[model samples]
Target: MAALLAAALAVTGCTAAEPGAAPRAEDARPTVISVTDGDVDLAILGEVYARVLTSGGYDVQLEIHSAQDPVSSADRLLAGEADFIVGCTGELLADFNPAGAEEIIDQWPELEEEGVGGFVVYDELIASLPSRLSATDPSSATSCDDAAEEQGLTQQVVPIFGATLFDREQREALTGITRLITTADLEDMEEAAEETGSVVEAVDEWVLDNEARSGGAFEDDREDVSYLYTP
Candidate 1:
């Protein structure tokens, strides 16, 4: 993993196109975004973002590793090897602020009874992020919410990014993607991937289905779908 990250950093900004060749469509792209990969669900989410961002005119690259561990992936994102990652609220809170995880989880049920809701954890996560990083508004969908109910954590899926890397338009586009996802949608995507034997193929099918269901809500053209988000 160390060697791979070093190699990625060594050539972070270098492009491979020949100088004399006529400008290709890729040449005009404004940003080349690097995204990290992890377990099956995270990998699916990464590809989903890649497709959405590509349609918005940015070049997206996925960094696949031999092993997919969430903590290591989060560390890589903090070190700036990649621009973005799909994370969860409770899980990331544990990763970034270990000592507080149990206390926060303990306090959650009472907060819910009093009507504070899941934002208790989400707000804590926002406060815990470093100055160099920012996270999108979390999706209602969580990779672990039901399965890990015993753990008393609300693992809301969220897109985390390097703050300095994206402009306002890019950030809003990503936030839009976050809002459109749901837990049921994620489960269906995973099932589709299992049947298709390819994450990309499954995500493509899911995108088409979503577009049709919402009257083309997930259109590729940025101008066609206007997403109004604050961050």
Candidate 2:
């Protein structure tokens, strides 16, 4: 995972701006470091976010860390090494409050088969989080039941971040991404990477195509992404 992250970063050239640099009015937002776990799917989700934020005129970096290591993404955020992360609600809640997560999971036994809204535990999950961290609105691209069967907990993809990492506009922009991407989109991205033989190119192409189709507010730049070809 570390190696893969390094490769992605190298391809994207996602470096912070030089110190003491003057900021243009349109690009004055603070630099953002988006972190993710070892899971490839989450990493892709995180990349999609980093790109959207970048399109919104912020400098963003993506980092991947081992989920179970002492130096995890949450640890990095707590230590101020990162600003935000893409996370699944139930799994994240379970990490922080296992007993509470189990209780919530137990309440919903018959999971729905179609795309659904937020899980029963979402509100509780937000309320239980530390004051320093905040979660954005959950995505309906996945539901608790499907996540429970595969991950033992509800796993809706959402952005968890430092409480004040983004201002109102930035937060809204991030939330818009959750609304735009769906489970089928994730599958398409994965399949595109396989077909193109270059994960970086595949993601870039998908983002471009989707932005056009959805008339998305965000604009994507191929030059901003470093991975044009697989190593």
Candidate 3:
């Protein structure tokens, strides 16, 4: 995971501006922008806003929070800890009462309209010798090698797969797969990787259709997926 994360940061070249630089009082800086910690989905949106804000001469401070708990985030805002909080519009509507906050900027309509959330993949690899087998779910009780042994599939299949931002957890739940190959993974792959969206949608549809063949159940809770976006 660390390696993948490092690769992602390297690929995106995400960085903050230099510290100790005094903000120009007349520069129309954004002052601050609060965000949930390590949200790959939100990061995509945040990066877009960050670039625009910077170009507009705003000295943006990206605040990483533990979660998008509105009450907590609003407390920070009320305390003057943050000038703006970037999160799901649903969360902002619920947590930040428009009557209470001085202003609100809803970005959900823009995000959804633009299809901002990119595709993600969870790659599962074998970590043993002979390396003759690899499967999505290691805990499947039925091993890939066992199936291969039964069917005489000697060639090792890398099991390259992908999923959308929403279905990632569902795919993980079915296969007991822990590691995920996010947009960051493709960014890291450089010449070897293609756009994650195309791969994820195709693989996600394939997984849905081949559930019986894969011996995996589709028990993804839609509510959990919703929480990824909602505060």
**Clashing pairs counted in every model:** 0, 3, 0
Q: Least accurate stretch of 10 residues (summed lDDT) in model 1?
A: 2-11
| Top of the candidates by TM-score | 1
lDDT against the true structure, each candidate: 0.61, 0.59, 0.31
Checking candidate 2 for backbone clashes, the offending pairs are 11-226, 11-227, 12-226
1-231 in candidate 2: lDDT tens per residue? 222221222212223223354432323333444444445567677677766656544456566555455665656666666667677787677766778877766665544333222456677778877886777788866533444576565577788876655544445555666767787777777787668765566677767777654335445543453321111
Local lDDT at 174 for model 2: 56
Per-model TM against the reference: 0.72, 0.71, 0.29
- List candidate 2 stretches off by more than 4 Å: 1-37, 67-70, 110-118, 143-147, 213-216, 222-231
Instruction: Give the clashing pairs for model 1.
Output: none
- Candidate scoring better on TM-score of 1 and 3: 1
What digit string (tens of lDDT, one per residue) describes model 3 on residues 1-231?
Answer: 322221221211112222343433323433455555433333332333333233333355555566545445445554555544433322232333432211212343343356541100011112221122112332211112332343221112122111110123332332332223233332333222135533223334433553344333222211111112223
Cα error, candidate 2, residue 136 (Å) = 1.9
lDDT of 1 by residue, 123-160 (tens): 88888889777877888888854324655777888888
